[model samples]
Target: MTYFRSMLPMTSEEMVFEAVRKCLDDAGLDAGDVDAVVCGSAPDAFDGYHHKGLVAVEPSGAFAKPFSRVFVGGGTGVGVTISGWWHIASGLFDKVLVVAWEKMSHPYPHAQPLFRSIFEPILEQPLGPNLIWIFALEMRRYMERHRLDKELIARVAVKNKANAMDHPYAQLGAKITVDDVLKSPVLVWPVHRLDISPTSDGAVALLFASEHEAKKITDTPVWVDGVGACLDSQYWTNRDLSYPYYVYLAAQQAYKMAGITNPLKEIDVFEPYDPFTYKELHHLDALLGKPGLAPQLLKEGQLERDGDHPTSPSGGLLGVGNPIAAAGLMKVAELYWQLSGRAGKRQVPNAYVGVAQAWGDLMQVGQVVVCRA
Candidate 1:
C-alpha cells in the first residue's frame, strides 16, 4: 500500500503499480499467476477521468485477464476484496489481485464539491447538501440517542490519531487531547474539523487465493473467513440516523458465515471505517451486534490497541488518511497484518479473529470482511 497523503507526487497508474507490485512481491508471485483482477475506485470525476477500470487495467496487472472495477462510494475498498473472494470462492479463479486506489488531489480547489453529485439530482441537489452537513445530522442523532457527551466522541479521534503514531503510512498521527478536538473548527454543529478525516490520495492492494494455492503461497496465510454487504434505503431521510441498521445486517450476515455468535468475545481486533470520529463508534456498535454498547467500551479503553477487543489499531481513516476506497481496503489489509502477526508495533496481543467494515453511499451501504489466522 502507498503512504496515505494529501498529494502524492505520482500519477494514478504509478500509484496502482506501486501498490499492486508491492502486494505481488510480498506474496512471491507474478502477474501471470493471477487469474483475475479487480480494481476498486470511486467516482471518475475525482480523478478527472472516465472508464477508470480501463485506465487501471495495465497498472493493476490485468492485461488480457478477467478484470472488473467496483465502486460503492466509500465502501469500494472492502467491496473489491469481497469481489475477489467470490472470484476464488466460486471456483472460477485460482488467484485474484484486488487493487483499490483514489486520487482526490487531481480535482481543482478541493474534492468535496464532487460529492454534490451523489445526492438525488431533482430532490437533494437543490439543497446543496454535502457530506459534512448530512454527517452532522447523523452525529447529532447518534449523540442524542445514546446520550453521549461530545468528549466521549472526541476520545475516538484522540485514540485513533495516537494509535496511528506507530503506522508508517499514516498521515495525521498525533498525540492530541479531547480539548484539541473540541477547540477545532466546527464545520457543522456537533462535527469538528478534527473529527473528520482528511481527503487523501493513495492505493492499497491485496491478493486472494484458494485454500489450495493459499497454502502454497504462505503457511501463515490469513484466511478470509467471512464476507457480507448490504445497502439501506438510498434516501437518508427514510432511515433512523441515530443508528445504522444496515451495518448491523451486514455484520450479522458475516458473523453467521464465520460461525461467530459472540462478536465482542470472538473477534479480537476491529478496523471499522472512521471517516468521522462518531462513525467509528457508530459502526463499532453495529459490528459488535450490540447497539449503544461501544460508548461504554470506549470509556473503559477497550478500543485501545493494548486493550481487550482492540479497534482501529491501524489508526483507521481518521489518522491513517481517507482516500475513499483505498482507506476501506487499508482496513482489510490491517486485518491481514494483525491476524498474521505482521502488524509490527501496532499488533494486538493474542488476536486470532478480526473484522473490518466500511460504510458508504449516503450512509446507506455497509461492507464487512472477517479474517482469521
Candidate 2:
C-alpha cells in the first residue's frame, strides 16, 4: 500500500491489471462476467499521460467492453464507486469493475511545482501556490478561529500513524509522539513535514453488482444505501476556511437519502479522506454537520479504533499511504470488511452502517457514500 523504490519500476497500467486480477480471483468471477469497466485515476498530470483511461483499459480488462473513466481531482477513489453505481442502478448492467490507481511516484520528492502547474495561469499561478501552502493558511485560520493550541492540532497525525501500526497495508505505520510532530520542521507555518500523507504508488479494485446479482455472488453483501456528491465554487480566497460548506451539503444529501436523522449514533464507522492531518478535522466537522467537533472529540479518545465513532480506522491516507485515487476506495473496502466483522486485527464491533468521504479540487468538491451490511 505504501510507495517504495521497487514499486516505481512498474507502470500504472500494470498496477491496475494486477489489482483487478486479484479482485476477480477473490470474488470467483472472470473478465467475461464483467458487464462494464470503470477506471478511477487522478489528474492526467500526475501520471504524465493525457488520456490515462484509454491507455489503461486493455491491460485493465476493458479491451472491447463498455468502458468509462472518472476523474475528480483527489475524489476519484470514491468517485469510481459513484460512477459504477449508475451502471447497476440504471438496469443496463449487472456487474461493473471499478478500478482506482495512482502513480504519484513519477514526480516524487517535490510535487509542489506539478501541483502549482494545475492552477489558473492568470490568477492563482501568479501566487506560486501549492496545496501545502494553501493548507497551512487554512490551518492557521481554523486554529485562530478556535483559539486552539498547535499541540492539539498535531494530535491527528500522531493518532493516525499510531493506529496504522495495526494496518497490514500501511506504509508509514509506526508509534510516534506529539512531540515528534512539534519537533518537525514547519514547511509553511502551521503545516509540518510529518503532518502530510506521503505520495504513493498503489491500486485498488472493487466489483459492483445489482441487488439480485449481489445475493448470488456472495452470501454476505454490503449494500450501497446512499450516495451524494457536490461541487462548490473555486472562490478559495473569498470563503472562510473554518468549515467546508460543500462537504456538509454532500453529507446531508447522503444522510437524507439514507433516511438517517442522526449520523453520529447511526453510522458505526467513518473514513474521511485525510491527505493532511488538519484535513481529517476539516472533513469531520463538515461530515458531522457541525464545526470544531473533531479536536474536542479527539482529545477525549472518541476517534480511536475502539471508540464510539472510529474515524480513519484503517489508518487513512495519513498512515496507510496516500495514492489519491486508491485511498478513498480503500476506505470503502475497509468499511465493507468492518461491517462484515472480517477486518481481522482492525475490526470494529457491530459496524452495521458506515460512511466514507472524499474531498478534491481546491477544497471545492465533496463526494460521499453510505453503506450497510
Candidate 3:
C-alpha cells in the first residue's frame, strides 16, 4: 500500500509549514501522527539566509521528532524524498513528510552570480563562469561530438514547452517551434534564452508512510519502490564534459533497487532533469544505459510525449519554471499524478512505472526515483 500528498507554499517558512499542514489534511492524519520529517533546499546564498535548515525546523513541525536535511544542489529536492522513504522502509518511522522549496524572489543577484558558489573558488570562479557557461559548453560538445545540429535541440525545447501548455504550474509554456528556439536570442554560444529554465519561486512537499500506514490513508497509493542518489568528484575539470557519470550511477542504483533491468522497456514514463535541453538527452542515455542510442532516438522523435517512452509529461524544467529544489520534486509530483490517474490531459496511456531524475551542482550530482502504480 502506498499513498502520498504534497503542498506548494508561497514563502520559505510557509512552504515548510503549509506542506506539513497539507499532508496531514489530505491524509486525515493529525500532526502528532507524523514520526519523522525530511527537508531540502538549495544553498543559503540563493535563499539569502545561512543554515536554512534551522529556519525550516519550526515550520516543518520537527521539534523533538526525528528529522534530517540533505543538500546536493538541484538534486536536493528528490534527495529529501528519498531520505523520507529510508526512514519508513528501515522500520525507524511509521510516517514521514518530505518538504522542498526554493525562493529565488528574495532579493539576490539573479541566480547566475550565486551559482558561482558551486564552482571551484581558486580556479573556476576566477574565470567569471556561471551555470549557463557549463551547460552551453556541454551543449556545444554534445553537438560537435554527435554531429547533431542545434535544430534538434531546439525541437526539444519546442516539444517540452508545448507539453507544458496544460500544466497549471508551468511558467514558460508556449507553442514554440524549432525555428523559434533557433531564432531566440543567444545567452551563451550555443545556448539560447528559450533553452534555459526560468528562475522561479516555489515549494513542493510529499508524504510517505510504511505499508501499514499507507493502506489506511488513501485508496490510490503510488509506491516508492526505488530511490538512488550519487555525486561525482567536485573536480568538474577531471571528468568528460559530454556525458554525466553521476546520472548513470544514480540510475543504475535506482534500477537495481527497483528490479528494473531495461529502463526503456520497463519504465512507462520519464521526467529527466532539463535545466538545459541537452541534459534531458544526456540523462536519457544514462537512464537507458546506452549512450550510443540517444542521438538516434532524438532524431526519430522517440523522446517526445507521444513517443514509445514518453518523457517530461509534466513539462520538466524546460517547460515548468525551475524553482531549484522544488523543480526536481515537481517531476516526482508529476509521477504521482500520472500513476494515480489524476493527470488529465498530460497523462500517458497505460503508464505503470515512472522514473524521475534530477542532475545539478557543477554537473556532478544526480538524484533518481522509481515509482509504481
Model 3 poorest 10 in a row by lDDT: 1-10
Q: After superposition, how far is residue 356 of candidate 2 from its true place, in Å?
A: 0.4
Shift in Å, residue 257, candidate 2: 1.2
If both were scored by TM-score, which would come out higher, candidate 2 or candidate 3? 2
What is the Cα-based lDDT of residue 201 in candidate 2? 82
| Winning model by lDDT | 1
Name the top TM-score candidate.
Answer: 1
lDDT of 3 by residue, 9-59 (tens): 355787667656766787898768888888888888777887887767787
Model 1: number of backbone collisions = 0
Clashes of each: 0, 0, 1
Error of 1 at 339 (Å): 0.5
On a 0 to 100 scale, what is the lDDT of residue 59 in model 2?
63
lDDT tens per residue, model 2, 70-128: 98888888888889987899999999999888888776564557888667789888987
Error of 1 at 58 (Å): 0.7
Q: Candidate 3, clashing residue pairs?
A: 2-221
Q: What is candidate 3's CA lDDT for residue 257?
A: 96
Off by over 4 Å in 3: 1-9
How many angstroms is residue 2 displaced in model 2 relative to the true structure, after the best TM-score fit? 8.6
lDDT (Cα, tens digit) per residue for candidate 1, span 108-201: 9999898898888998899988768999989999999999999999999999999999999999999999999999998898899999999999
